[model samples]
Target: MKKSLVAALAVFSLVNAEQISIGGTSFERVDALKAYEVGCASNDADACFEAGWIHYQRQNLNKAIELYTRACNANNYKACTNLGALYFSGEGVKVDIKKAKELFSKACELGDGDGCNNTAFLYEQKKDIKTALKLYKKACDLGHQIACGAYKELSK
Candidate 1:
């Protein structure tokens, strides 16, 4: 039994080594992604956010949602924004307008500009112009240049 266990451990190590070696082909980005994944698994919100970004880049929206959810749950503002976006866009999950609003509010409360911008857009679509304007202003104040431009265009 001990010998078998030792053999299993060796196999596991070998697998890990091969995985790492494969990553070494694009070492900088791959290593960074691995580190972020590990950090996310270890309950680091920022790391979870980073891992979500990696998944997003790979167009793995479901995986991105999973990591973003973890980060949002851990109080990462950007992650909250991302989660709101996922709900709003119906990319990784079904559209839940109310849930998207809630997540956007959470991100906005945490001072995420992107969240404010997205929330504003949602409000605008609903014809809640006043609320949309307010959120757009907030996003602009937060230095989200795109929001500022959008608000300007819409106000005209």
Candidate 2:
């Protein structure tokens, strides 16, 4: 009986431990954000994006990054595009221009017109005007009207 009690207590403690090994902690504040988390975890891209943005607004960049990464990994094009933007701007994580381009390209390949436009903008900033023009044209052809204007502006 004593051995069983000890085993049960050990299991309970393990379950209740605060450390988060995989995705980092779920966060105590995550309770209030449960609805969003549920939807995100259930593969709702918009919910994941919104939750990530909300956390970013609250200055919880790590949480935002975590949520954004999950959504992106789930094949959420918008999330991938947004995460690329974050990487480019050094908003949440360190500035990684190369990584940003990779993410933007991934999002674009997934049919995210916005991602194409964003990638073009990043390339423009890098003085790779030709590639930027090409991506902007692609975005415009993909029905991103704003990209047309941006393309014209940057092409000059």
The CA lDDT at 94 in model 1 is 98
Question: Which lDDT tens digits does candidate 1 get at residues 95-124?
Answer: 999999999988988898998998898899
**What is the Å distance of residue 95 in model 1 from its true position?**
1.9
Provide the overall lDDT of each model, using Cα atoms, as 2-decimal numbers: 0.78, 0.75
CA displacement after TM-score superposition, residue 39 of candidate 1 (Å): 1.2
lDDT of 2: 0.75
Error of 2 at 100 (Å): 1.1
What are the clashing pairs of model 2?
none
Candidate 1 lDDT score relative to the true structure: 0.78
Best by TM-score: 1
Candidate 2 — worst ten consecutive residues by lDDT sum?
A: 16-25
